[model samples]
Target: MPVSLWAMEPMMPLADMPAMVLTPARVSQPQSEAPASVTVIDRNLIEASGARELYEVLKLVPGMTAIKVDGNVPTVAYHGTQARDSRRMLVLLDGRSQYQPGLSRVNWNDMPVDIRDVERIEVTRGPAAAAYGANAFTAVVNIITRDPRDISKHTVSVRGGNNGILDGRAAAVGHGDNTAWRASVSRRADDGYDEPFEGETRPDRKRIETLNTEWVWESDSHNTFALQVGGSQSRLERQQESGVADIGRYTREPVQKGERAFLGLEWQHVFSATHQLKISTYGQYNKEVTDFGVCYLDPFTGQQGPGGALLFSQELRELYSQNGGDTAATFAAVPTSGPVLSRYGSLQGVAGVNFCADSELDLQEERYDLEVQDTWQINDRMRLVSGANVRHDRVSSQAYLSGTEDNVSYRLFGNLAVDVLSPLTLNLGGYWERDQINGEHFSPRGGVSWRVAPGHTLRYVYSRAVRTPDIYEDQAITNIQALDMSEPFASNPEALLGWSPSYFFITQSSPGTLKPEKIRSEEIGYYGQFRFLELDVRYFQEELTDLLSHALNPFEFEPNNEGWVKHQGTEAQLTFRPTVNHLLRLTGAHIHTHTNKKTETRIAARDSGSALWAWQLASQWGVSTAYYFANDYNDYRYERADLQIRFRHRAGPAELEWRAVIQHALNKEPIVFEENQYQEDRMWLELEMKI
Candidate 1:
């Protein structure tokens, strides 16, 4: 329960010592012994950054990119591959995967745990599927929260910022002889984007409330049991609007709201000093309530000749399905954006439709996961860590998935680290999975760590991994129907049914016929530790095949494994804390990508980096500054500088603190999307009390 017992404990570099990590190999070892490169962001650095969201803190990692896809949805990616849907990156919150199995995306800001509770973050900057399972393709991010005993008995904090930002948080801790518990709650709300893009209103606002609780019991000296319960409710504003058109533009303002809950249990038994076993089980439930308006054509009453209503969006939806989702003939069968409209005033574009009616996107996703791990210190020269997990996932969605889709998957993984030669360690690991949809898959890794000097190490690694398609990617039938948003339909239509055809049936599906995306990676890395400096650098080359990308059809939403990309790059991160009064951190990445597809390179930032400097003026006064420099990728750049100052004072039995932060965007260029860029400077003020 102490701060020193972090998952990847490096002791915060207080003295001259190499940081030990557990994520790289599932066993605790110093950075000099690990086979891969890793970046550790501790609690001190996280607080010094003055970031309110987890995604904002992720920018300090090398080769890491964080952006918003839909203006409201926060997405973080490593190597900038597919920033819209970072399917290749595996994210974990206290060992539980954060990758959504149904939506095939990660909701960075919708996590149940508040950022204030996080103790540290460990980032493995390459393929780590051997220790983890399938989704650990490009990188692995592990967020570890603080234990109850590490914090005060009670604490409360609130912050208000420019551009409609507000947050309120409270936490309490209690303990008996052998048990310690903590409970925390937070309410976060923000008005997304400072202004509207070109024409569309910036409707990317969000409101969320979360509750997280943890109980750790030392049943005995040999057995420990830990339980965690968490839940969150969020309302994320979503809207889709089109440009100017002769048929009158179409817009769908849908409020995507959802509830997420999870219960996790872990039992750790220490048989002896050298041997230990841990069993973990968790169950999660996610329910999303959302609906959007649709405008469809009455197929029975509308024209149905060879070149009639059949060429509209609804008819083409069925035609594309009946003939397999590979061809674009159906989309071609319709007309492009022009004056001549299709029959029955069908959708003028892919997502456009004339009229509208009510529709609901309601779905429930459930997951049951269980895993057992064993760590054995066989002797002085060898160590073994092995684990296996079984998972069952199911989803029910009438609006998107027609009905229900469920599957059960299993994985077996293990790693062995041995001192093959003095000053050299050989690590070998593998993971094998029997997936319900992706079938049988295997990931393997081999690495060698050579300690050349007292505090210097050189490492070489080769790894192969795969990413299975998600539930929606594997099987989903998404379509909606409405009369029209305008004009004489039925004054007010009834709920959606089988009576009419669909509108804007831009479905994204690939059932029973999709291969998992695979990656072959090789890297040369180095890690060094000194009295006041810690450095990690890596040069990697990756070849990816069978990547999930859009099908040939530009109008429809279908994903297939037809993309190939090769990347050669280098990334480095360094931390320098010469004394207790000053701290400095720097990170940079140079990316060179070779790919024929434009979609693959949409977010590949050629040269990107970040820097942070903090100063402790007095015992109660502190100030920090941060700079984020980005590339001109996608014809847009985000360069920003931030200054944060804080003052702490003693008041009665509680400690009072006041903090302020100001951020100035230097480039003033559009961000991920044209509608998301903010040119003005942002400011925030916070007040906190601890007892």
Candidate 2:
């Protein structure tokens, strides 16, 4: 059936589409409009799906990918670009860049606000480095909270389900003619699925509790001010140890926890009709801790053992010695100025007789940002858009077992846009960004969007982005080696000392000398609407240089010079709405990537490819089922995987959801050299409500 383009349309006029997230100042309008690439995920879409996390919500979006390696720690990829080391997305809460300078990655667990309070998510899926600066390689996520006025209702929600999952949320807003305030809190816990592909997968568990509070004062349309304070604490217990040698080996005790907090203030002013300015400042703090069991050595047998086990064994041995048996000292550390110490010495005080660890990773960050954006209507047929952003940032970290490091950064960025013709917009943006840790860089961006028809648009974009090195990659000094030195020196005690001091490489020494990773990305896409159908398609490719790779061979690994990696992908989405209340969407994607070098000695290739399909349905009554198929990287690196499913049903304001994810669904055995490269299967169920 052929139908008019206006047969199916949103209730609101397109020009008045909510600009709370992708604000009017940033969006590219038709002729005589600002020029930029922006995508807005509305609050309605959020409530309809009842998504619990950002990862699930981003799956349906174009030019983006949210990865759940463990279902708890999420990572995002934008454009056709995959992360080489750190996240390439610059995520902002309101107007403050929520970047952790110490790690060069956002602590997903520490994102202060719950999805419930999000009014809209404005995603610029390209090198916004010119405007956003650091970590804006693949894209930027601008999370805007709801206005306090519209959220006058108080609501509370609670849910529980499989894997010991439990969730609770509460929110309320108070609004006056000139003053408004909002407060919200949300908590979720789950005994997550076991580590897939690893043998004897044990249940990993995580809990996140978040709180956000804000106050806004507005005077007419020219002046507005807001102050926001947000905090979140998430504790994760995975089977892997923080400083352990091999993550795949050994069943470590559950002992990992992470916590974060943030506070921010913002002010906006309009000076006349064509100029506006916004200033924002924010501070954030994060702390993480991990505990591994104690370690010790036996005296008589000269064998390694747990601290508790060794203590018990030593007591028995002492008893035997008192009864005229042989006495032996397991670990005799001769103090320089005192008698020889007979007890074991903890590794840098992280290990002890009890093996209870207090080691922690801590980061504190502060930022001040100022932006001036203006829309100048030069004439009836042409408009000009220009803006400048200045940012100052400080990041500090204290590692419980290691030491401390601090870094400071500053950036100045600007962009210009011109509407060439009616319904056509062209943009050119660029920025000069500098960081204390990575020196300085210049990133440039160009984009064009054309309204080919009444309800159709064609767009092309090219941009350059950057990713900074993290403390973990730049300064983390590991003592663990792939070939256990102890095994080779079991017979001869002095053999271990023969290893050179450079055996365990230290990649970083100077702080401000590391270079930033660079990415060049190009994209073209089309969006069209006809009758009950809407189709969107995009194809993108990203070229990367000076990428960071975790090298299994320490001797060959270096920072910044690991060569290049490439990521390319195709995305397509189709939506069909037979009626106002009945809507269905189908999304498909194909991603292919390759690194300059392989991470393993046995594998000669560092390439991976995957194809995925997702289908969704919606109605007011709320019963929807989705199917997903994923084929793993088809190389010697890892084995392939298969289909997954999710089902959801809503009763009242409460929603019940279920997920069944299978890893290596088709493969039975390990094709790679990795141990226990086998299939992983699990099912999860969840229930949520709103009051």
Candidate 3:
């Protein structure tokens, strides 16, 4: 994988703050009524936790691990799977998809909305393919922004802290009796780690700027219209930390930069008190330019063969294809060790000085989606929701795909819930989707919920889901077109014959070869609501097959789907809010993974938990303390504690709010990896005003 594919921070520790969610079954219903386990973080929880990024707040959810892959790019994975190329989950921003199909990843920093603008976040901690089709294999993260009518007239927020952290946001709202609109702009920057664990002065830094706006109009009781427009630009310093290619490498300025924009419109019509229809469409565009100069020595974390040969060269692959998998003839054509080294020089033959590859992971992706959904309350005991959507995705990447490719996907999904008996309810849903590349698939989900008592319920759910391979995974041609050599090779380029060519190509583009990742999940859950406390607990077992992975050695790297893995876990979340002045929240999960290879556990966590306690000391003062624990990624334990204080004051008609937070790592020395080690402590202070 290119360095740009390098895909959270100390968890801004979850308060069970929301009682209703709209993600589980695509309807606004009490959390207890949803078919899946749901966790919600409200704006109040966001304020008390002092979380500046979306992924930071996600640590509150059970069975979810949010971390920075290289202490720069934000990655949030449920039941942690391969994180560097985090896939299998679906992310939505106000009903619009935030995932890039081109890379099959989420650029959380480049998202237009700021943390302050988010009203609430709901996570469905299970497969949602029955409702969202493919790519909802593990979970769904739904971010709901503050409604235009609910935004304050004017708001400003600013924060600065250690590690070169600086952030600022400004928002304005304009509204009348019939219409409301909101506009906001924000900027954030951070200078990562003083120094890396292994290497000193690592080039790791990030900056992002965003502009967002929304407009809503109520055209009478039966009709409503909404429009949204947003854009963001981001810059990140990329550092390739490991392998011979990266060792002793000097720092470079900004290595990657990206810009993205989106436009959306929606119309809702209410035919009756119990029936409604919604039609929505959105268009999104994103472009990224990346630059890196590195030698092709060793790419994978684990070295292979004798000196980690660069055998997966495009020339050898082409020769192999041309010779019909005749390895003898193929190698004969592109000899590994000859006078000229044939097409690709042997790893033992090429020294560091004779190799230079102008590597770029540049790409542009565009997506358009249109959806129509209808909901009907057939009776007091029956509810039905159904929807259909079509998505068109276009990706252009000369380095990744070698050309432009477009695919159209169509999906039809529906969910029905009926009270079969006085205390039992049944939920049945399915999704049928057809994609140009992934073909057609139908996933079904069935669940039953029994209301044990007035405030308690039990649920059993079963679902089947799939994750289609991304464009880069299916049709990848990773290479550098321009090859620049130094010294000896520059003086006598022809002496090497046609070994290096004009450039060194990594993989020959292969389309329609890899299969989709598939999963089957079974869960038993319980929810209880009382006057003083609430509880949500779940036990789940997931079996995944045809997983996508490849060896790091370019010569041996071939995307294949034959792996099998199973994960079983229990997740629980509890909230104790006896009074409005005090609150206590706890969340935890324990998982055991059985993979084809035991050494592959680095992508999954064995145990994770968090606790938070808050007190309203006075009318204008409040304090909160949070702690997080997670371990078992190569047996590395991560522990962190957070303490925060909030203050508010009145200035004429405006209100001034202040927040200060301190986070410290509790682990003396936990080894996540050899190259990237997190700082021991981080701190920040924030000021916000509303007029």
Candidate 4:
């Protein structure tokens, strides 16, 4: 294939490169001088990879795991602790948090910004509590978008491909003497995987719309102000089953709708060469609604019952009838039947008769945050960065919580850096935080970086991080309301009249409130830049305690902090660029975990690696290929390859670019979410024009 001339764009020289990190220290420091391990993915790599989604780009980061259970639902795990609701890591969009307090999960499908608007992504692959308070237990991801000044003209993009994928986006930027503004709108839809697991329904289908706008004003070099606003709406198809006994049936084609909006303002001022200050405020609102329904059979007679009713055993039904709706006695009575009732029954039952009640888990949350920070250059060798913030969260849910709940939190953090000697630097940082639900706690971090040689640097770091219990875990109220049996069995009172007329509630609450999960970590890292290669290697060990897990008592299933886990890992990344048009990148990680509970081991991969090759055949065309592999785990194992080809041309006043990407080129099927779904090969083509 012939490559385009643009594909031969010169790479930035390593010597002149400045520190591009943002999340590690909340300050721009040279990559070699940063205390923590950081990975930066720039726009050039993003464009060359031909990736259409944000999660796909994260695969390049060492020790980071990106799992897409379906097209619309994706989870990213750092340091080997993943779950259905991943809450250990914090994600930020241009410094604004995307974490939802109600669910404690990041809704990747509903993010306001499209992939085309993103300029770079910074990932800190370790505990970040010292910089960002609680919930930064494992790692942090910060996404930075292109500034108005960086957008030279208007652009439009359109993409279409297999599996019903279609996407469209339009962006425009305007500049003035003292101000600049940017606005963008995007719409995307995909059919997802065509084939679902046997007896299961397809879940990856999705449609989403988003809008984003930003304005900035630079009065002078001393002062600057910026404002940003974004909103998104998404509709996704999911397959979920009920957890209730005898009622666990697959819900095919269940649709979930989400709406989100955010507004932010930032101001910075330079008092002098020695002192600078910045203040930022942001507010976010999100609401999700899904019509979740299930079907079940009556436990006693093994006959299909009403779709939405909560049915009990024959003995409990008789007890309720005799006791006149006494929930205590009704629950105390044990089943005398020989066989145990199955939570998930066969799907062959009749529809209307086996239909359970129509229920919905509707969650709505609002958050407001304000923070101010100062950067002081104490002297030529010493610097200090300090900040404090206040946050308030309001959550309302019908299925998860009692009612509207309010949580207020406050945090104070500071970091000090000192150059003790010519080639050695020391950093110390800590954060103190207090919240209405979790009380008060403190986390600390310390590190030292040494320039062992002209091209090599070594770093040793120690840190502690915490993960606070989320709203659902701390105050969940699972209500199972029984349907009225009076009318159905009025003719035969003895058979059905004994059933309870009220609801059965399963509530999880702790008298002392659950303690936050805590982890202490120690790491040693080496970074080196050679004539044709750049290498980064790190070894880390972490001890985690007070982890949250469900109580073992059969009578109740509340959450408790009674888990201990230890993890040790080694990760490395190697980038070899022999010439301007040829490049090779290799990344690998090996992790071992010991846990008091056996289930935790399934969350992380034991070994994983990827090898990528890119080449510019000619000026107008380019090609890239990659192979990714992961050791077999309990749930899944995969080895897949990908290919991308790009073409570019000039059309009068507009520039046109086209790219085609093939994922899972070998057509391998990978199981995800306990074999409920399988990921299949896919192909997509994108065309973009800039004027």
Candidate 2, residues 8-72, lDDT tens digits: the string is 23444333332232432353443112233455566655544445665555655654545444435
TM-score, cand. 1: 0.89
Candidate 1 regions exceeding 4 Å error are 1-15, 241-252, 294-355, 481-511, 551-555
TM-score each candidate: 0.89, 0.73, 0.88, 0.89
**What TM-score would you give candidate 3 relative to the actual structure?**
0.88
Q: Write the per-residue lDDT of candidate 1 for residues 563-583, one digit (tens) a residue.
A: 888999999998888766678
Write candidate 3's Cα lDDT for 323-381 as tens digits: 65555566566544342244344444555342434546678999999999999999999
Alpha-carbon shift of residue 198 in model 4 (angstroms): 1.9
Error of 3 at 73 (Å): 1.1
Off by over 4 Å in 4: 1-9, 242-245, 248-253, 306-356, 480-512, 550-558, 665-669, 672-679
Worst 10 residues of 1 by lDDT: 1-10
- Pick out the ten consecutive residues of candidate 2 with the lowest summed lDDT: 501-510
Q: Judging by TM-score against the true structure, name the best candidate.
A: 1
Which lDDT values do the candidates have, in the order given? 0.78, 0.54, 0.78, 0.75
**Model 2 spans with C-alpha error above 4 angstroms:** 1-39, 79-86, 194-203, 242-254, 296-302, 305-358, 361-392, 398-404, 471-512, 551-557, 599-620, 633-691
Which structure among the candidates has the greatest lDDT?
Answer: 3
Q: How accurate is candidate 4 locally (lDDT)?
A: 0.75
Query: 484-586 in candidate 4: lDDT tens per residue?
Result: 3323432332333233333333333334477899999999999887777778899999988998744321124546788888889999988777777877788
